[model samples]
Target chain A: MALDQSFVGRTYPPSRPYEVGREKIREFAEAIGDDNPAYRDAEAAKALGHPDVIAPPTFVFSVSYQEAESVVRDPKLGLDYARVVHRDQQFAYHRPVRAGDVLSVTSTIESIKSLAGNEVLDIRGEVQDAEGQPVVTVHTKLVARAVEAGGTGGAGEAAEGE
Target chain B: MTAQIAYADVEEGTQLPLRTFPVDRARLVRYAGASGDFNPIHWNERFAKEVGLPDVIAHGMFTMAEAARVITDWTGDPGALLEYGVRFTKPVVVPDDGKGAVIEVAAKVAKKLDDQARTVQVDLTVTSAGSKVLGMSRAVVALG
Candidate 1:
């Protein structure tokens, strides 16, 4: 099913503030097997001029992707959750998110297009701190595979590979 | 933030070290829990196969993080990373056996985007099982 083109340019409300904690950052860093001292040691981070231990570059995706649920899961949008696959991801950081920062995300639908019997979605999230200062801009692309009509339907690959 | 590399010393085409990360089922589970991405394809072999994948696979984000480590490890400062991006070209299929998948990452300075801010673009070649998993992978970082 093709996505609603009108949904393009739609903006969603900001989510409640999510507090950045030292332990969470440490856990995420460890999960990725990154032993960067700045992610665990405040002193190490401070030595690098950060007010506190800074998050790894991809940490905000946990928050931003959650906020994007408002759009991807909208009943009116007719998206098939099971058929969706992540395609592309990008982040533009204004500054590294540090421990003790309270952040919120406002999501927007950047674009929607259909190709090769698949629906592709583009979502951009603006991540900000408590004072509304930009922390990072998260852009994600999701692809919904085309169902085969008794034809050999390959597992969704093309869109993801693109 | 202070970077380990001095901007005055680096030029375009500077090569960063190559890194190889081991990806096991346990690591995938830990990543799913920490990142709040509990996609079954990452941890469930049956589910992954049922979904058309060869076997259990690692999350695209997980591969991306492994690739970014090359830059952060070089700069010695996470704050030096100004931008990062990647295209999910292929999935890193992780088998259930004790020896899981291995992701190899190599990076280099592809462009000198700025002088005053001391920012440069680093391009990464991320491969798993000799197949490119992340395409057009790159990061823009500021140097000391």
Candidate 2:
């Protein structure tokens, strides 16, 4: 089934503010095996001109992807949650996300297309600080594999050589 | 704010140092928890095979973050990163055994974008298990 074309350009409501904490940033940095002092030490970050420890660039993906759930799970969209695979990700930052910053994301459906029987959805997340200042923009592309004719509840067979 | 790297010192085609990051099942589990992307293909071998993956695979975002370290380490400032992007071309399949896959990343200055902002674009080549995992990976960063 094709995704709702009308959904394109629709912007969802801003998500609840998520307070960025030093510990969360530290945990994420550790998970990725990044030991950058600026990510874990306040003094290191302050020396780099940040108020406190800053998050790795990818840390914001957790918050942005969470905010995009509202779009992916929209009942009217008819998207198959199980068939989706992430394809591409991009981020443009106005500044590094720092601890103590309360952040919110507003997601907008940039485009929807179908290729090789796969449903492709493009979502752009606008991240902002507590004072509504722009922090970063996240662009995400999700590919929902077309359901097989006789298969149920699984992604379509992986495209050969993809 | 002063960037650790002085803009005058860098030139197009200057290569950043290569770095290799190891990814094991344990690391994937931690990444899954931290990123909130509990995709079974990253942690469940059976679920991964059922979903058409060879075996448990590391999260694409995790691979991307690992690649970014090349730039961050050179700049010495996470905030210096202005733009970053990548295309997930292949999965970094992680085995249950102790020896997990290693992602090797090599980067270089691709272009000098703005003199005033001291911005330069860096292109990265990332491989895991001897297969390219990310395509067109690049980062734009500001230097002093």
Candidate 3:
């Protein structure tokens, strides 16, 4: 099923503020095998001018993706979760997320289109501190591959994105 | 401190050191737990194949995190990064073999986006098994 184009520009409500925790940042860094001191030690982060331990740049994706689930789960939008694959991801940060900062996300559907028989959706997320200060802007692109009639739907060699 | 690279020392075409990140099933499970992205395609080979993927695949964000290491290790500060973007053109298929897979990264300062703030845009060439995994991979960093 094709997505509803009118849903483009729909902005979801701000999510509950999430605390940026040092332990979570450390866990994320260690999971990726990154030993950057700034990600683990408060003093190391402070030395770099951050008030508390800083998260790796990609850290916000975890939080934002969770929040974006609201859009994916929006029955009105009719997005089939299983058909979706990640296409592109981008982030612009005014500042790195610190250990103690509280953050919230507001997601907007940027665009909806069909390409190569796949439905492509773009969502832009605005992340702000508790004070409503911009922390980062995230853009995520997802593609929903067309399900063919003969069950060759997901099995095609076209190799859609992930 | 802020950025180990001297603002004056870096210019367009300054090459960053190459780095390699090893990926395996164990690491994916760990990342899935930490990142909360338990999309079975990343850990379950059977599920991945059922979804038309060749084998167990690493998360795109996982490969992205590995690519950024080349910059973070060089800057010596993880927070120095200002912007990062990439298109998932290819998946890094991680096999069940004990050796797993390796993502090789090479980067260079593609442009100096700012002169006063000491910011530069770095372009990356990331590959897995000699195949480009991320398209238009780029990052803007604060060298202040």
Candidate 4:
């Protein structure tokens, strides 16, 4: 089944505020093997004009994508999670996310399209600070593959085009 | 702190230094934990195979981060990164083998967007196993 076309332009409520922790930023940096001092040392970040340790540019994906769960899990959307694959991701930032800042996200369905038996859904996440100021806008595209004929759409079925 | 690269000195077609990042299973596990994305395909080989993936794969977000290093490392300022985007063209498959897989990232200054903002648009090519993994990868950054 294709995603509900009506869901397009629907905006979900803002998620609970998530505090950006220094340790979490450090852990994320380490996981990606990015030893940029600004990601670790407050002093280093301060030297770069940031108040504290700033997250790597991609760190916001953790928060923004999690917020997209509301859309992905929407029963009305009829998305088959098992057959879904990440298609594209883009982030436009107002500033680098800094440690100790609290952020919230409001996810909105940007578009829903069907192409070649695949459902392409785009969700835009608006991340804001405690002051209600925009921090970053994250755009994500997910493609749900169509189930094969006479097949149960069970596990081990690869999506076409890899 | 690494010295910030001045915007005035950068020219179109300037290539950023290349960097290679190794993606082993252990790193994927840590990334999953930190990102709160417990997608089994990124960690469990059985689940990945069940999903028709070759083996355990690195998270697409993880691959994006690794590729951004070229820009960040060049500017020496994370905050300088203003915009970034990528299309997941292929998976960075990580086998159980100790060597895992390596992502090679090469980037260049494709264009200069704004002189007043000192912003330059960067184009990136990210590859794994000699195959492109991220397509249309680009970044906009503020320079000194």
Candidate 5:
């Protein structure tokens, strides 16, 4: 099924504030095998001129993806989570995210299109600090393969162009 | 600590030094916990295979984070990076045989901009076993 074209440009409400923590930053850095001291050492972060321990660049995705639930779960949009393929992601950071900062995200549907029975939806997640300053903007493109598409009924079905 | 690599010191097509890192099941579990992705496909081989994955795969964000490390390590400050993005072209599948996967991250100076801030554009890639796992990875960093 094609996603609702009318849903384009629809902006969702801001999500509840997510408090950034030092432990989570450390864990994320370790998970990626990044041993940068700024991720775990307060003094190292301060020496680098950060107010607190700073999050790794991709940390904002946790909050942003949650905000995207607004669009993906919308009944009007008619999305099938089982058939979704994450196509692309981009981040434009106005400022680096640091620990102890509470942040919120607002998601908006930027565009929708249908190509070869696949529904492509572009969703934008804008991250802001407690003071309402923009921290980063996450642009995510997700493609849902139409159920009727041939050879898509089973698992392991790669999306087109894979 | 500001960037050691200044905008005036580099130009288009200058390749940054490469850094390779390993991605194992332990790391994937930590990533799932930290990022709250908690997807079974990233940790459970049985579940992953049932869902059609060739094997337990690393999260896309995990690979992006590795690429981010390459930039931050060079610049010496995470804040030095102003923008970064990537297209997840392939999955980093971690075979549970204790012989983890590796992502070789290499970067190049794609462009330079003129301004008081002195920003440089960096192009990055994450490859594993001759396959490009992440593509079109870019970063803009403020230089000293």
Candidate 6:
């Protein structure tokens, strides 16, 4: 089923603030094998002009993707979660994310299009601090493969009838 | 400071070395916990199957993070990055086995910035089962 075109350009409400903690930042850095001291040592981060231990660039994904649930999981959108492939991701950082900051994300459906029988979703997640300062903007593109019509269980067929 | 490759030393076709990193269920769970994602599709195979996924999958950010490692390691400093982006072209399906998945990433100097910093663009992809899990991915790093 094709997604609802009307859902395009829809904007979701701001998500609840997620507090950045030292432990979470530390864990994320360690999980990716990043031994950068700015991710774990507060003093070191301060010495480098950051208020606290700063998060890696991808850390915003934790907050942004959750905020995107308002769009991707919307029943009206008729999206097939199973067939969706992550297509692209880009981040524009205004400043480094710090441990003591509380952040919220507002997600919007930037575009919906069809290419070569596949559905593509472009979602923009704008993250801000508690005081409403922009921290980063996350743009994600996802492709949902079109379902094949009983063609002997081909490419997109595995995603159907879920 | 001494630099191996400087802004003036690189060109468009310069090929940086490739990197491979592991992605397992345990790491996915830890990512879910730390990031507060908690999406059932990343951790529960049953839920993933019920929702039309072949099996539990790794988070897109997980793949991107592994890709970013290649650039940061090459620069010798994480702070040397200015901007980065990628398209999650495929789902990294992690089958339930002790063996984890791997993401391979490579980079090059795509463009030069006006300042002393050069914009090093990276190309990255992840694969499993001889299938391309992610594609069309790129990252831009700032180097002195």
Measured against the true chain A, the candidates' chain A TM-scores are: 0.93, 0.92, 0.93, 0.92, 0.92, 0.90
Estimate, for each residue in A1-162, the C-alpha lDDT of model 5 and write its tens digit. 667788999999999999998888888787777788888999989888887889888889988998896679887777988777777888898878999989999999999999888788899999999999999999998878766635434455442112
Per-residue accuracy of model 1 over A48-117 as CA lDDT, tens digit each? 9998999999999999999887678988888987677888999999999999999999999999999888
Query: What stretches of model 3 exceed 4 Å from their correct place?
Result: A153-160
> Which candidate number has the best TM-score?
1
Better of 2 and 6 by lDDT: 2
Cα interface RMSD of each candidate: 2.2, 3.6, 1.9, 3.4, 3.0, 5.0
* lDDT winner, 2 or 5: 2
Q: Is the docking of candidate 1 incorrect, acceptable, medium or high quality?
A: medium
Candidate 6, residue B42: how far the Cα is off, in Å? 4.3
- In Å, residue A59's CA in model 4 sits off its true spot by 1.0
Model 3: lDDT to the true structure: 0.88
How well does candidate 1 score on lDDT at residue A115?
87
How big is the positional error of residue A130 in model 5, measured in Å on the Cα after superposition?
1.2
Off by over 4 Å in 5: A148-162
Give a tens-digit lDDT track for model 2, residues B1-144.
456788899999999999999999999999999888887778888887776667888888999999999999899988999999998888888898899899999999999999988999999999988888899899999998
Error of 6 at B127 (Å): 4.8
Candidates' DockQ values? 0.69, 0.56, 0.68, 0.59, 0.59, 0.39
For model 1, the stretches where C-alpha displacement exceeds 4 angstroms are A156-162
- Give the local distance difference test score of model 4: 0.87
* CA shift of B105, model 5, Å: 1.2
lDDT of 5 at A126: 91
| Stretch of 10 with least lDDT, candidate 5 chain B | B1-10
Tens-digit lDDT track for model 5 on B57-139?
88888888888888888888888998887887888878978788998999988878656889888999779878888878888
Model 3: colliding residue pairs: none
